[model samples]
Target: MTKHNNLQSISVRIAVKTPAVSRALEEIVSTLDGFEQQLDEKATQTDVLVLEVGDNPAKEFETVRALLEDGVVNQVFLTSAKTTTDILLPALRTGAKQFFQQPLVFQEVQQAFVDIHKERIAGEGIAVEKVSIKPGKMVSVLGAKGGVGTTTVAVNLAVSLNRLYPEKTIALVDMNRVLGEVTVFLDLQTEFNWDELVKNISRLDPAYLAKALIQSAPGLYVMPAPNSIESGSQVSSQVMKQVLETTKNSFDFVIVDAGTQVGASAFRIFSSSDTIALITTLSLPCIINVKRLLGTMRLLGSIPMNNINIIANRFEKKSAISLEDTEKMTGHSVYSTLPNDYQKTLEAINTGKPLVDVAKNSQLVKSLNKLAESLIVKEEPVVKRKSWFW
Candidate 1:
């Protein structure tokens, strides 16, 4: 890709047979600047593809697939009146980057065009240098049960890590498929989420990942989960693994909030994580669930006991379930204990800020810092191995 110093417009190719779809594209193109429409035959020369589903949806999908497979087009925008799963699923499987229903919204199409423009500009400046990328440490935070403060630990831990290592890049991923609340905790208003990335997982790279991330802090980026339940279910294990692999390559620390529900995607993330923080409290039910979770992990053998860090959240000195008993039951030592500071924790949650920022002197913040330090220490060995052994 060559950069044009006086580039005025982005070239777009439309291949829709549907009259309504063609009109929609024409209207969208007319309203947007730096965008020029091209004939369908110019697919090889255009920067975007607006392919509308016709009488034969399967054939249209195949056309899209072939264009992508042959590298003739990098961006494909699909339009369809039949938005049923039968049609949409196959269309997406064919590597269609975006979908638009009949009577396409200008705003949606405009955003897609903007993304293409940004991607093109970024691609033009790519150098041929072979930069070494050390795979980052992935830490998956799993809750024994719901309402166990799993998100709290994950969010604060990520913030603390970012603070501790000001020069390193840190990302926090909310892997909770159905009910992820990481964005709410951080008070981030994100226009794009994991769903958008999953739709184009095949095109994922450092640049694309960087665009998808929402900067919650100066050095901390967050990939929030989908807002709707339907979109959440679409996040397959394959997509999760791809996202984690890409993120691990791009950042120094990747903290994932893997909510209580354990599914195929959760298992894939668990297997990839350098440390799996199994969060629990002193409650008996929580301990039992933790024990069961450990048994399941042991059975799978993907996550070793050593890598599994048992975290006791909301720890109280006078709790009936002592730390020793909790350890014996869970068959793993408590890696860290967070004091029960209810008011402080609630304040942070309500304010949509990390505990480290809201309650700097809180014991919870100190515990999270300790956790971050441990993770940094663990990463030192990997860096040494990469430098010396590799």
Candidate 2:
């Protein structure tokens, strides 16, 4: 019921048989920020309950599960001197968020309490009703073939959105399993990657997600690909679906650099996206690939035809194939075009900066910015009603 530093106070109830573990838990809970110890033995409900195993371990586990299922306690932490599989597995299955041995480790207890505090804080944010903010929009950029500037468009568009809408939350995700260039494009050094999200799919709450994403200089949050092929291989389409679903509620816009990947996984990405920025050049092979990809999407019948937006990268008037010709070949009109600034784009990549930052006045940056603007949905203004007194 009390508040500490603007955070609601967390009430902790400790029920431990061991004298040493009881004392340690008391100390740890006392030291935790925004946490208060509930000494009332008769209290049935609390924010967090720390329970130690008793002689009848099975009965105790049942009681703990019931308490959680009935919403009597928000979270439960179990402790036991026995580290056997029977004890540990039951404790985990009983819905305990953390477990400590009889001889508790101070640092581990402290870290567990810290994680709980973060989750509680994030939970408060979620409890508040959504007013002006709605679910986020996702835009996935994919190249018809290699070297079509897919990453370039994704990175610069995200940066431009961050610049244009400073208050809105933006996320840039690299969906490539190996050798993804999203971080290199933005010059970002990420501590976490999409692999973490897949491994901790059950913990895909706001608190965990915030920790897994790193914010770049432009204020856009980025989730890079795995560092190695093995880690990338562990990510599955179902897990990526969960990640995207969780992120949609947390940000205003999510930009994905879906580097040339095909199959069920790639299909999931394209289907989940609100707009699929299919990037290609005027080359014949690229056009043919585009036509094939379109047919694949059409056959799958997951994404709408209009949702696929064809973008011509490095467009030049003298190119072998014109935009109209390419459209006729692919059965889709060109949605947008980026001017060919080979030298400028190269310098931007070499410097690890977005085209917008490298040359704001250049045609490439202008085109990218315009592309970013088209994806944003403008909210209608609310009309004020006249007061009776007025």
Whole-model Cα lDDT of every candidate shown, in order: 0.80, 0.82
Ten contiguous residues minimizing lDDT sum, candidate 1: 381-390
Model 2 Cα lDDT, one tens digit per residue, 30-71: 876789999887887899999999789999999999999999
Backbone clashes under 3 angstroms, per model:
0, 0
Can you tell me which runs of candidate 1 are displaced by over 4 Å?
1-132, 378-390
RMSD (Cα, Å) of candidate 2? 11.0
Q: TM-score for every candidate vs. truth?
A: 0.68, 0.69
lDDT of 1 by residue, 138-182 (tens): 899999999999999999999998898776778899988877899
What lDDT is reached at residue 78 by model 2?
90
> Which residue pairs collide in model 1, if any?
none
